[model samples]
Target chain A: METQKTHILRRLFFSTLYLSAFTFGGGYVIVTLLKNRFVDQYHWIDEDEMLDLVAIAQSAPGAIAVNGAIVVGYKLAGLTGVAVSVLGAVIPPMAILTVVSYCYDAFSTNPYIAAMLGGMRAGVGAVITSVVYDMGKNVVRAGDPVNVVIMILSFCISYFLNVNVVFIIIAVAVFGALRSVAAQKAGERS
Target chain B: MICLRLFLSFMQIGCFCFGGGYAAMPLIEEQVVTANHWLTMNAFSDLVTIAEMTPGPIAINAATFVGTQVAGPAGAVAATCGYIFPSCLFVTLLAYVYTRFRNLSLIQQTLASLRPAVVALIAKAGIGILIAAFFVNGTFSLAAGNVSFRMILYFAAALVLLRKAKLNPILVMVLCGAAEVIFYCAGTLIR
Candidate 1:
């Protein structure tokens, strides 16, 4: 068990640090890559579990990487995994960026960087879109048409209606909870 | 005083940031643009734009950018560390407790309940970004819109490439960046 703990933490650290190093756009993009690596490549927890990790991480009060470290760690090695993973993710990015800090004044307004960023920004958005669609495949399953409708509605509310995240989350939680309760009662009845 | 204030303010942002950096933008707008009066909406928007292009959370990038702009290297360090401290502290402690409570049924039940709600938030957040990224005049239309056609094309193309091809995102971004610069120059020369 102890040897297993070391291996898991080691793998998580390297994976997250790689993400921190390469991820240029945002944390959401990192999450996508993470889902690919941990879920697709390693089969760490499968796709649904990975989506759940992202969801919980998103709703929690912290940086995305930190939340991921915690949740993935817990899933893998209880608490120790979370500790090492979060530390791994946070330290490298922070350190490297601080070094890059020395160049901010010189390079911040560079025309080339600015031009490249314009395209990269749009690409990041696209990546997010693709990731959401990928995640939706599982979250919105064929067994339930409600998941599909809820997803579409939520998307509209967020995009067009501009609803608060807290409100949307509360609505879904209440609905899912009620459904679970209803299912339990029906189970008892039968 | 200014440096100290920026440090503390960023710490607040970092501590309370749920989701990712983009999700924290509204609050950041409130604190930096509205409350502190350090920057206008335009400046904040520019900062966000630059932060998005960089390699970390916008919150961290904001701290580094603003800190450097406000003071210097020390300010940057102060603000970045302040922003990160809360999560580091929280995760370390939570991991410790979680290690001890791995098999607890109540915790399992609570986590299960929380998962779907999380999906809603993720979906909602995606919509919000999509709307902001694409919508114009309270309606979303890719045709005959004021929004940049290049951006939309990149978005659509990248989505297809990502889903279909086994290409690296970094490589895609690099190729797209080169194309954008070429197109930008061509547009400028034509105009």
Candidate 2:
């Protein structure tokens, strides 16, 4: 049991490390990659569980990637898992920045680096669109009209209205909580 | 003392940075550039470019870079730990609560509702990045002149490869970068 636990921790560390090291375009992209790895590849977590983890990560303060690593880590092992995963997630950025700091001008001014980044951003955008499609499909699969409406409204409000995401999340969370309470009461009455 | 200051400053940014991603940029600019005077606006812009190009959250990259500029490697560690500390505490606590109460109907319903909203948020973020990727100067314009054909090709090709070929996303990203380098070299040769 002890060895097995250690092995799982090691795997968790390296998985997050590799994901963090390669994932570009920030939190959403990394979260999408995490879902792919954990749900599709490793099968450690189910689709529903991954969605819940993402919601929590998004609603939380700080980098969603770090918050994501923490929750996924906790789910897999516990607090110790959280520590290892967070360490792995952070190591790449710190190491890269440390090196970049030493040669700031050369690193930042290089046209080749800029061109590569431009292309990667395009690729990153594609990956994010795929994530939206997959996650949106799951929401639509539930056949909840209200949820479908909410999804559409949420997208329009955020994308078109340019509202702060924190407010949107808070609004949806309250509506969800109130909905759950109402359903509970209705069930009791029935 | 400087390390302590860096830790505290980043801790404050971490505590207040909700929604992550670009949301933290203004707060960071205010703290590191405006209040602390750690970096000039020009240097901070460079930092932003570096953060965007690099493979981590902008907040983490910013913390590490600013910390390194202010002090050294120790400063980087201190600032990073401070930045991530709140996330660790909050996520661990939330995860514990979530796992413990997952079977509860209220938790389940709330999660069910949250699922759609989260998807919307992801969609919105994706569109924002897509515009940034496909348009010139990261602005949306209908003009053909404003469209970046090369970036559009990269986007379309990547989407096809990911959805059809099921290629590893990291590998796709590297391929796009390599393709861009080749294109750049070819363009220079033609000129």
Candidate 3:
């Protein structure tokens, strides 16, 4: 049992390390990648469960990538899993940035590097838009009118009005809680 | 003392960084550029570009880079630890609660409701990056001179590859970068 536990931890570490190293876009991209790996590939987690994990990650205060890693790790193992996963997630960027910081001049002024980054940013943008479409379709397919409306209003408030996301999350969560309570009470009455 | 200051400042940034890495930019700018004067605005912008270019959370990348600039390797460790500490604490507690009560209808419903909001958040972040990628100055402008057709082509091609062909995202990113480099070389040759 102990050996199996250690083996899982090791796998968790390497998976996060690989994902963190290669994921360039940011939180949502990493989250999508994580879902693909854990849910689609590893079969360690189910589709609905992954959505819940992502929602928790987004509502929390920190990088969604790290938060997703922590939660997924915890689900897989425990606190030790969290430590190993977080360490793996952090190392690559820290190491690369340290090197980049030492020789800032070379990296900043290289036109070729800039051009590549420019292209990568465009690619990252497309990847994120893909993620949005996938997740939005799932929400719409759930057949929840309230959820559909919330999704649209949340996007408008965030993209157009530029409202802080934290507020939107809190507002929707409270609305969900209140609605849940009302539903429960009605069910009890019936 | 410098390391301590870096750690504390980044700890504050970590505590307040909601949504994701991009949302943390203003808070980081406030701490690193305005309040501390550790880096000039131009350097800060450069740092952001580097952060976006690299593969990691922008907050973690920024903290490590700024910490190294202020002190050294130790400073990088300190700043990074500070930035990640809150996540460890908050996520563990939240995870425990979530796993314990997830079967409860209240929790389940709440999570269900959060799904669409989370989608919205991701959409907003994606559109922001998309605008930055396609526009000359990172804002929407229909003026022909302000749009980059090259980037739009790259974006459309990437979308097709990802959605239709179902290529690995990392592979798609590499292909786009390589294509851009070839375009750059060809343009120079034509000149």
Worst 10 residues of 1 chain A by lDDT: A99-108
Residue clash pairs of candidate 3:
none
For model 1, the stretches where C-alpha displacement exceeds 4 angstroms are: A1-64, A67-88, A99-109, A142-157, A166-190, B1-97, B104-145, B187-191
Best candidate (score: DockQ): 3
Give fnat (model 2). 0.78
Candidate 1 vs 2: which has more DockQ:
2
Summarize candidate 1's per-residue lDDT along A63-127 as a digit string, tens digits: 78657766776777765676677667766555655655566446547876556655665565665
Scored by lDDT, model 2 comes in at: 0.81
TM-score of chain A, predicted model 1, versus the true chain A, to 2 decimals? 0.57
Model 3, runs deviating above 4 Å: A1-85, A100-105, B1-79, B94-105
Q: TM-score, each model?
A: 0.60, 0.66, 0.70
Candidate 3's displacement at residue A63, Å, is: 5.2
Over the stretch B3-114, how does candidate 1's per-residue lDDT look in tens digits?
Answer: 7888787777766565464545644654576568766443454455455455667776667766766777777767776776676666555545545653333333333444
Accuracy of chain B in candidate 2 (TM-score): 0.59
Q: List the residue pairs that clash in candidate 2.
A: none
- Which prediction has more favorable TM-score, 1 or 3? 3
Candidate ordering by DockQ (highest first): 3, 2, 1
Interface RMSD (Å) of candidate 2: 5.1
| RMSD (Å) per prediction | 6.9, 6.6, 5.6
Order the candidate numbers by lDDT, best to worst: 3, 2, 1
lDDT of 1 at A61: 55
Pick out the ten consecutive residues of candidate 2 chain A with the lowest summed lDDT: A161-170
